[model samples]
Target: MFHTESDVVFVKGLTVEAVIGVYAWERAITQPLLIDIALETDISRAAISDNVNDALNYKAVCDDVSAWCQAIKAQLLEHLAGQIADKLLAKYSCHKITLSVAKPTASSKRIRLGCRSRVMQRSSKISQL
Candidate 1:
């Protein structure tokens, strides 16, 4: 039977500098964004095997996230968040993903995109590593 119980792997307070926003001034400069991510996956194999190869490689995820953030010229937090979710879900072996994105200098505290329950759909769109 498929395992029903799962574990959460998370990364918090990862700061990414990206050119995000729609305004003229906002588009002109890169801003620092705080990102938090949660991934749901079964790690029983890794736990039993005691091998890094058996586990989810968080370093790779962080590296890819940082690279995508830098490479994407997305204008909105929501859009970027969705793109990130879709990309990670497609690339990683996670069942679900949750993300929180915040502009430290923006008027509001944060913008949260809804959780993605499915992977690789690519309709639209981490971590403190």
Candidate 2:
């Protein structure tokens, strides 16, 4: 049985190139996107048993997100972020997830603008991490 306690695993500053944009010129080529993800899970069993199966494999998650992002074209950051959340929620063992997708060069040369999306499965009650 899975534990009820919520533990968060995060990956930050993961930059990937994707075909995401609103303008025609922007969509002509790939742009850099910075993705941050937090997944809420119960890692007590993994911590105790020191088994990889008991915990989320962040590398696999990163690879999946990177591949998916590269393959999709989105006109809005919200849509892209939401897709990532949905994919992870369906594929991983986490009850809740928080994702931030940023286009570091979207608005201005120095300004980073994007969206954040969070999703939780209703079947599982998520605890504060």
Q: Among these predicted structures, which one has the highest TM-score?
A: 2
Highest lDDT model number: 2
- Each model's TM-score? 0.80, 0.87
lDDT of 1 at 84: 87
lDDT of each: 0.77, 0.88
- Estimate, for each residue in 1-129, the C-alpha lDDT of model 1 and write its tens digit: 356676888988888888988899998999888888888888888888899999999888888888888788788877788778878888899878887777777766465432233332444312321
Compose the digit string of candidate 2's lDDT tens values, residues 1-129. 565577899999999999999899988999999999999987888889888888789899999999989987888998888778988988998889999999997876688898999888523332222
Q: After superposition, how far is residue 12 of candidate 1 from its true place, in Å?
A: 0.6
Error of 2 at 123 (Å): 12
Off by over 4 Å in 2: 1-5, 122-129
In angstroms, what RMSD does candidate 1 have relative to the true structure?
Answer: 6.0
